[model samples]
Target: MPAARQHLFLLCLLLPISLSYEIQLILVNNCNYSVWPGVLGSAGHATPEDGGFHLGLGEEAVFDVPSWWSGRVWGRQGCGFDGQGKGSCDSGDCGGMLQCKGAGGAPPATVVEMTFGTDRSPLHFYDVSLVDGFNLPVTMAPVGGGVGCGVAGCEVDLNVCCPSKLEVKRNGKVVGCKSACLALKADKYCCTGDYGSPKICKPTLFSHLFKSICPRAYSFAFDDSSSLNICRASRYLITFCPPAR
Candidate 1:
């Protein structure tokens, strides 16, 4: 082929490549437990000896959202990332940057960094849950943990089953919202039973359907079954959305 034709062919091949950008799912191995909190006991490896408060296993971080993850995400019962908390979904469990128990029935997730890669969505730091301050397993604490939180580690506070739905915001900007969008889910956050206890419901302001029932030290863990891995305090997990164009 002539030189001009060859150059044209090269441009055609590279055109698609230029439009896409690379995103990184960088893992910081925060908290410095350095013990390698693993899933199957052989999955992940811990690094540092110690640093700040160890995040433990199954604990993901929700870093400042990337510019690419602008669409909707799987929010749980209340926290809304895009202005609509769990209340928007049919299940009424949406929230901004949430940490769910399992992978919401998705395939074995491969934490990704780039926006246009083969891996699935890229989630910045996952919104982690707590079981209070007790770093040990449930068998050890029996009552569970609380928070030794400072800033990001501070026990994420939220009005659980509040009677009057308060406003929601993402860094001062409304994300998941639409006037009455904060309305409570029927048969779910009823004023009757189900999470009526102060632990589940505050009753004064409104029950905090999601706040951790932990002391000043320990954290309120979500799923007890995952305690073993969490106790390791080494192996940790992080989720993210694929970077955007």
Candidate 2:
């Protein structure tokens, strides 16, 4: 084969590898206590760390996810796993297991969501969502991903100010805050049925309160205009129980 043809063949063979980049995520537990981080990859995607793992106070966990990975991360508190990894948590429990293993955490749990784009569309979208309610303060910030990469999270503890009706208490102490949809189970609050569309599903009083406290997070389903953040970064820092801003 001619030199030019050989070079073209090599390029073709390498194209797919170049397109499938890996993204690094550094998850830190900054809370005063230990936290079990739960991961739930989107359908058909690979779940890292077997879906969950333990992170002691001041400790961190790192993983390299495919650029096409889309998933949600959350923290489980007050957990107790037996020798066989069978146990539960006061908040964010996933089927009473230490390793969530593809299971989603039980709300009310603070959630960090990320959807990375493939080579065809390289933008990464992320948000700290309170839609399932808040178990702890958390933040997701890009590392050295140039300007326009906004941070998404809530720095302040929401459980402290959680409304009485939405509080998830454990042992007489508030551990999580439930969304109105979870607390009331009303179609209007859940944005179901007649209130499904963005136009019809405006923010409710509870969501408005959440927005006021955490402006950078998703207070409801239609909070895309402000809560959704876009960027292109290979590394992200997700801190649970992040310091208050």
Candidate 3:
């Protein structure tokens, strides 16, 4: 197997078997630097890890979440905090704190969204979304999901080619690519008010560019048909800076 797959397999073998009743999620940091991962559960769902944690280079954090949980995960970069855990990140900050709690990550950050299986249905739905924009290269894939299961993410770094108007820079380096909606704030770009409907909301040039590059991720709010992935996996892997295939 390739080195990346081999690493994933080794990580899977290390998972605890006692979490049979819950779904397992492994957040791996394969980047050269450390990453702070933020988690936020949907309404009525429980947030795990108190919503945030740190993962050093090549490190991984494992969680056994409720089987019926639904949440989103994103990475925060260039962050620092005091003893009180009060600070901010260059990208994807949440309430200027180390732990995001229930707050969502700021836009221009790559996001991994998931809904695990419930008692009534064994299907689990997940996807990597760029609708908010892109700050990191991330991937979400099933560890042992059965046939037809697909990976959802943008493996390529979008900041490198981000449009000048939509680029978010820190220290003279491009760190994120803002979505058209965020950069323009127009009803047409945001698909709000009269453009809220799918019939009226169409992909802009920027969204089309995003879609062309990150085909498996949501480029716009109405991008659902092909971006969503449904499966039945007890364990899923979310990796930051996933090695290029």
Error of 1 at 163 (Å): 14
Q: Which segments of model 2 are wrong by more than 4 Å?
A: 1-11
Tens digit of per-residue lDDT, candidate 3, span 1-245: 99999998987886534333588999999989889999999999988998998899999999999888999999999889999999988899999988898999998899999988865577888999998999999999989766557999999999989999999999998888999999999989888999999999999999999999889899998996778999877889999999999
Query: Which 10 consecutive residues of model 3 have the lowest summed lDDT?
Result: 13-22
Question: On residues 130-225, what C-alpha lDDT tens digit does candidate 2 reach at each position?
Answer: 999999999999988644699899988989999999999999999999999999999899999999989999999999999999999989888866
Cα deviation at 230, candidate 1, in Å, is: 32
Best by lDDT: 2
**Where in model 1 is the C-alpha error above 4 Å?**
29-245
Candidate topping TM-score: 2
TM-score of 1: 0.24
Predicted candidate 1 versus true structure: per-residue lDDT over 1-245, tens digit per residue: 99999999999999866754432222333222221111110113121111111233334432222223221122122122333211122111212112331212011111111111112332222222222111111111101222221111222222232123433443553222211212444323332366534356322212223223322211222222222211211112232111111
Residue 22 lDDT, candidate 3, scale 0-100:
82
- What TM-score, computed on C-alpha atoms, does each candidate reach? 0.24, 0.94, 0.90
